[model samples]
Target: MTAEAETTTGSGTTTTSGRRPGTGGVTARRWAPGTQVLWRYRDNAGGRVHICRPVTVVQDTDELLAVWMAPGTECVKPVLLDGSPVHAEPLATRYTAPRTTARARWTGAGVLKLARPGEPWSVWLFWEPGWLFRSWYVNLEEPRTRWACGVDSEDHFLDISVYPDRSWLWRDEDEFEQAQRSGLMGPEQARRVREAGRAAAEVIRSWGSPFADGWEHWRPDPGWAVPALPADWDRAPARTAP
Candidate 1:
């Protein structure tokens, strides 16, 4: 995973930014093209994290790459042909579908930001593995802002996210209120989250993944070893001098 550029929020620390360009048309590519190459980078604190997820690049334009991962998206084996992880740590994070959330229930897109080590935000998108459904992004998730796009499974959309400090909270008012008390977001961050709702609505209008029977893409074949979890998955990250 790579940091395209470090963005400083009005707060301390850097807000790394990456914009998933607006998707093209379904005819723009193909829905569920192939196993797409996914680059994930995650750090528990400020150190390297367990990494995995790789796909071969078949075609790449200056803007996009037609990629695929062998064994498809379910290959959780810890090593690739080069002894790298089938998946790897991520730089920042994208969004994904939550396992328990019912589809078509997205109120809107949202965002959150924490400069220090703590729970990040939750983000969701609509994408497919075999083809590219560029019009809309699918998948729903909690801790939504912690991930980007990865693999589109057959049963549902499988997304990647940095381990979250806060757990998944269905769009209940309690969770919304907690986000306020947690000091995880600021006025600007909250505004961005609100704007994210536009993307969510757009995906819906386009009938994308998790929004478009993405639940069908959720099943993952249990084969290789899934990544091991840190001793504490829910602990907020602590800032350390690099």
Candidate 2:
């Protein structure tokens, strides 16, 4: 999770050039649907991976990258060093407290993550146990940097929850503020993240492509197997041309 130099696109997705998967040659290519890849997030204080989920590619193209995290998939997530849930810790010490990674099954409903290349945030769709449409979560963060293994980004600690009625509410403002106070994010970075959140709100208001698209009815392919968490889940990702 080294901080590699990145170029930003007009839409704000991060781009870099490096090695291609399967081929020793350097090139950018879409991951075929059903391909298993790791979607990871680097720790806020350090560039080490703190969150990693193995997902199956639903669709991949120049416009969007869609991945499905099936229920019960094993994943890595941060927890208090004492083995408590991070959220259970008080906000005052949440960001500053020491933490470690833990492996756990992705309980509850699966998630469908949709990201337009260069967008500063990704939209995650959720459902209830019976496939009942729940809501869309706007995760404000750095645009994903594509690599041979998968994609990586740093979470901004801010988010938006969009309901089925098209209504939305800001989420994690306290965490965002606390993250800055804890020095995990600088003032300038926080400003950019706020700007990014606003941009996402604008899209939600306008009822953009993803929201307008009928993804709520979409279902995972019955033949697609749940992707397994790889042994090297935290392996360094090789940059790939966008």
Candidate 3:
């Protein structure tokens, strides 16, 4: 649903980091709170971006990167070539349908994304119109690759929804299965995604840091302006060596 940043040690304790974990031994500088950045996801089949949202940084330490995607922020999202919403299509042909990007505004309440570095999933907080805390959503995906403009990951389709009472349920399972059947994901990749889902479920069962972190009470700064969707929202990120 959304994304952010934080750090965890080998023992699973949360801590702060001045620089993000780097590839090729080069640490990446963290974005300051309130900085604008693009959060994006690439299509499962091709490396082309299919979803993009501009969000304001809430926190950017190595232990966690948090961001607020304010209501009304313009964004790019996938849609059927017929200009229909992707979810409106039948599951049988959803992933097989021709699709394209469409610019739209994020409606309703915004989301707070909490992500730990190198984790395969990010947790998101949602609220109702009056700021009534809704629930936490675990979006299982690949570890986000960070670049100067923002971060990118490929969605794994499988997800979990955690409620206030600590009860949780799997979400998008049909979509997950459909994706594999549509050839968007190979059998091996699907297996790994399922493994990641089980791993995330274990964390949920234990009531881990993010779910217990009190992010539901978190609110955005009143002074922070909503980030604009930039013209180059789909710009390719600079490559980082493994």
TM-score of each: 0.29, 0.89, 0.89
lDDT of 1 by residue, 1-119 (tens): 12355443332223333432332311121113232333233322232322333433333222222333333233222233344332342212211111111111112221111111111
Which candidate number maximizes lDDT? 2
| Segments in model 3 whose C-alpha atoms lie over 4 Å from true places | 1-24, 239-242
Location of the lowest summed lDDT over 10 successive residues in candidate 3: 11-20
Write the residue-wise lDDT of candidate 2 on 1-242 in tens digits: 11334454443234434553433654345676777888999998989999999998888766789999999999999999999999999999998888999999999999999998889999999999899999999999898998877999999999999999999999999999999889999989999999999999999999997999999999999898888888899988888755
Each model's lDDT comes to 0.29, 0.87, 0.85
The C-alpha RMSD of each candidate to the native structure, in angstroms, is 16.8, 7.5, 6.2
- For model 2, the local distance difference test gives 0.87
In candidate 3, list every pair of residues with a backbone clash: 4-65, 5-64, 5-65, 6-63, 6-64, 6-65, 7-62, 7-63, 7-64
Candidate 1 RMSD to the correct structure: 16.8
* lDDT head-to-head 2 vs 3, winner: 2
> How many clashes does each candidate structure show, in the order listed?
52, 2, 9
TM-score of 1: 0.29
Candidate 2 colliding pairs, count: 2
Q: Tell me the lDDT of model 3 at 71.
A: 99
